[model samples]
Target: MTQKNNHTIARSWDEFSEQLLGFIISRIHHKEDAEDILQEVYLKSINNIDKLQEDSNLNAWLYTVTRNAINDYFRNKQKNKETITQDIFTEDTDALNIKDSFCCLEPHINELPGKYKEVILLSEIEGLKHQEIADKLKLSLSAIKSRVVRGREMLKEKFVTCCKYRIDENGKLAGEPDCQRPECNH
Candidate 1:
């Protein structure tokens, strides 16, 4: 690339980082994930710097890249079928029915053998793309995709089973129990 083009790319990147960061953050709820997406955007922009022309349109180009990344993230998430484990461990144990209703999903996640757990965590928690997960795990794209699918199904079944059997001593439904769990109290 010419020096002028290089300067333009650098300037445009710096000017748009803040807006791009916010845009990515809004799409992905986690702050850390948003930051990681921003980093990916920077890397992608740098690698494709040759295609960027006309300084005025730089913002639009950057946004397009971001939209693509976000779409890829969601598509991978759906392919993976990963359900976020709602954590409710810190609350009072007096509501064992409720506690049992909401057991720690980390254990279930831990049960996933091999890269399935890693793929699910990265795709769901870290908001990474399939390609990103493949790169991170040094596995083939097909392998990553497969793991996400099977792993998510396993988690869903596990969560459903755990939630179903949860009942108070009085045999009442956990959700309609006479008392509230400490975590839900607030």
Candidate 2:
């Protein structure tokens, strides 16, 4: 490798290693596995450094590599598993809290216009694939996809209007909603 490229890689490692490791750990509960993924990300960044455009953001590029590495790790794990176990797919507390927070949106979802309501119920609540939803509804796959997207947009608008939910700068739902209805209590 060229001296300048080596220097750039070293600099990136010094800056992003800790943050990348933390990101991996947040997704993967096992510390050892997270560390391994972090190392793989580092190696990938080293090998692919030259392919990165000169004007491209280095931080964003490294993050993309780290995310891909984490995904590969999970894919390999899934392929090797003969059967799924609760422990292997356990939901972290944060995920559970997020799910619970969305429960208040149930009533608002029902209030949506029929077309959107049907698609959202099947896709989100019933956990069906888009193709499955399309087949069941006898609609084109593109139509089903469009409905799901539009349904989510409508749902977000309802959350903002009915519940007074505000999105923060990061686009995440922020603060407690002023929900006074009995159905919104959950």
Candidate 3:
């Protein structure tokens, strides 16, 4: 990129990143992922700066890019989630899969921060619908949904980062954890 464009990007970063950081974090559950997406927004905006119709629209354009990045994160998360299932009752799932896959899950859940822990326990363990959770927690339906999504993503992050586990094609946690992270022993 040219020096002028580089300067422009630097200026943009200074002007908008602080505002967008909170905005991005509001939608994203993981702090590292949210920061990564914010960086992506900056890079994408710089690369596509010339395409923007007006200089005045840059702020809005950045917001658009940040929003799209968050959407993509959730979209990919959903696709990854599709390759993992909690349904151990199905004949195809088998008892072995359940016994081996979830040995560390309860401990990880116990380690979760309060709100995340609460939502996961309520939805997954207590079998409460999102609406029912909303009623009981006195949270908005959207807030309840957001908490559930965030809670699951947080758990998935822990599994991926600490346990080094990935969901197999058959929707089970496959392979052993690397045990590189301090809390990764499984």
Candidate 4:
């Protein structure tokens, strides 16, 4: 019975992936996110295949799962947005100064390892707070804070090593792009 169920699922994926992906892609702006949702829908459908009563209903069931996944994505996105208080949005000169120096940082950011990379992108690039970052990564608040601190330290090291940036009198990053490292792309 399990074998037959697996076979059915394989057939369904082969037949419906393109159609489902099209539906998902239309609803989702990003191609990668839409593909991820489709993969989630596929996993859920296969894992619970026995719960599906009939093969005739497979397409509808897949669509339902895809819809639920899309809803989950938006729900999480909305939750992340809600976590940032209005106060955090206001520009502090110190933060703005640091952000300004950190401009043209795409390559440095991409070089960060694993979830640390994601944390920096979310917290620094996207301006999510510690709690918001924690919510997004499903990590403890302290863990998120630690990762942010650690990630920043690593990034600072990279800047110093790669671009020769140093602290100014005001303690903000100060340097011209050295363009020494090929990856620095300065």
Output the number of the TM-score-best candidate.
4
Clashes of 1: 0
Clashing pairs in 1: none
lDDT of each: 0.65, 0.71, 0.69, 0.71
Comparing 1 and 4 on TM-score, the stronger one: 4
Clashing pairs in 2: none
| lDDT winner, 1 or 4 | 4
lDDT of 1 by residue, 47-166 (tens): 887887665587798899888888877676544332242222222334544444333345667778767788878876556888999998898999998988787667655544544323
Off by over 4 Å in 2: 83-186
lDDT of 2 by residue, 77-118 (tens): 543321111111123223433344455555766888999999
Q: Over all chains combined, what TM-score does candidate 2 have?
A: 0.44
Please give the TM-score that candidate 1 achieves against the real structure. 0.50
Against the hidden reference, what TM-scores do the models get? 0.50, 0.44, 0.47, 0.51
What does the lDDT come to for candidate 1?
0.65
Between candidates 1 and 2, the lDDT winner: 2
lDDT of 1 at 158: 53
